[model samples]
Every structure is written in structure tokens, then in C-alpha cells.
Target: MEDTDFIVNYVKSKLITINLEILIAKDGEDGVRKGQIERPNLIIADLMLPKMDGFEVCQQINSNPKTKDTRIIIMSTRNSKENVLRCYKLGIDDYLIKPFGLDDFEQRITRLLYS
Candidate 1:
């Protein structure tokens, strides 16, 4: 779901303490495919992904019956009003701008996973 290794590693580092299984998808298509199969409780995706964008990724996963309940958090550097509003309209649970802090990230994850 995440495009860069740094963010992925950061996510892993943060999520490790929570004991959640992590899955990596190389691209948007891969993310959708894996989500259909794994149906994880939550998904965190980057906006400017290769092969497909975050918006499409959210659409496909949200539309799929198997993964419809999966909580999604969209991450992007561009926190435009349009982008954030679009993500919300697509039924994404939350959105995060890039360079977010560990505490904020953890809080959001906990909220989505537990709420």
C-alpha cells in the first residue's frame, strides 16, 4: 500500500509494538488483490502510488464486498481541500498528511483498529 520504504519501515516499527500482522503491496493493483484475500482490519495507503493511485485503491477496496469493512487511512503530501474531501467522499475512514508524527499515526491506527 505504501510506496516508499521509509514510510513502510516507519509503519512497521510503529506497528510492531501492537502485534498486528503487516502486509506489503507493491502497487495499487497488488494492494487490492491482497486486500481481497487477506481482508485485514485496516489498510494504510499512499496517494501517489505507482500502477494505480490511492483514490482508485480506496474505490476498489471499498467497493469490494469482502473488503468493504476494512478501515482505510490515506496518506499524502498534498493536503489540499479537494484531495481530503475526495477521500472522505470515497468512504475512507481517515487521511494523514505526509511527515506525520509517530504519536499521531499510532493514535489514528488505534482508533481505526479499535473503534
Candidate 2:
């Protein structure tokens, strides 16, 4: 996961108790680097990231043959239809809006990871 401190910390805390390995990046560039290096099965990112922004990150990762099959769930406050369409166009698996409840977040993650 790559996002603000609060979101990253909160999600990390929640997943750690469940024994999940969380790789975090503070900016879009670092996120892309980690995505390439770690090759995680799922990536949860915020749209308004520093440096390159999440859209570009998704584009780059999805374009790469090594990471193209990886599932992506974008979390952001920008829930416009245009943004959602753009995410899907970039091959995102899911687009989750920010301020979502824990149950909703968990459900989305579960669906993407297990379904």
C-alpha cells in the first residue's frame, strides 16, 4: 500500500495482526519501484500521490508484462465517473472511494484477493 501516513499505518496495523506482509511506499515513484521489486499480488493506492500520481503508477504497472496480471484496487476521494472509467481503462481490478467503512474495505480486499 502507498498513501498518506494515516491510511498506510491504519491498513498496515490491520493487516499485520492477520499476518499479512505489507510493503509501503510514500510517493508514486517509490510505489512503482516497490511494485516492480516486490511484485505483490494486490496493490492498494491513493490517487493524489506525490511525484507521479496514482494514475500514472497504474498505467506503468499495468503496461509492464511482469506486473500486468497483478490486481489493483485504487482508494481515493476522487470518485468521479471519469476517474472510475480511467482506472478500468488502465486495467484496475477495483476502484474504492475513500472514507469507506472497514467492512466495505475488507470486503473489497477479500473479493480481490480471494475471488
lDDT at residue 8 of model 2 (Cα atoms): 83
Model 1: residues >4 Å from true position, as ranges?
none
The whole-model lDDT of each prediction reads 0.92, 0.84
Question: Lowest summed lDDT over 10 consecutive residues: which window, candidate 2?
Answer: 11-20
Segments of candidate 2 deviating more than 4 angstroms: none
Clashes of each: 0, 0
Tell me how far the alpha carbon of residue 49 in candidate 2 is from the true structure, in angstroms, after superposition: 0.6
| Model 2 global lDDT (CA atoms, 0 to 1) | 0.84
**Looking at candidate 2, what is the lDDT of residue 25?**
85
| Strongest candidate by TM-score | 1
For residues 11-35, what per-residue lDDT tens digits would candidate 1 score against the true structure? Answer: 8898888788999999999999999
TM-score of each: 0.97, 0.92
Candidate 1 has a TM-score of: 0.97
lDDT measured at residue 28 in model 1 versus the true structure, 0 to 100: 93
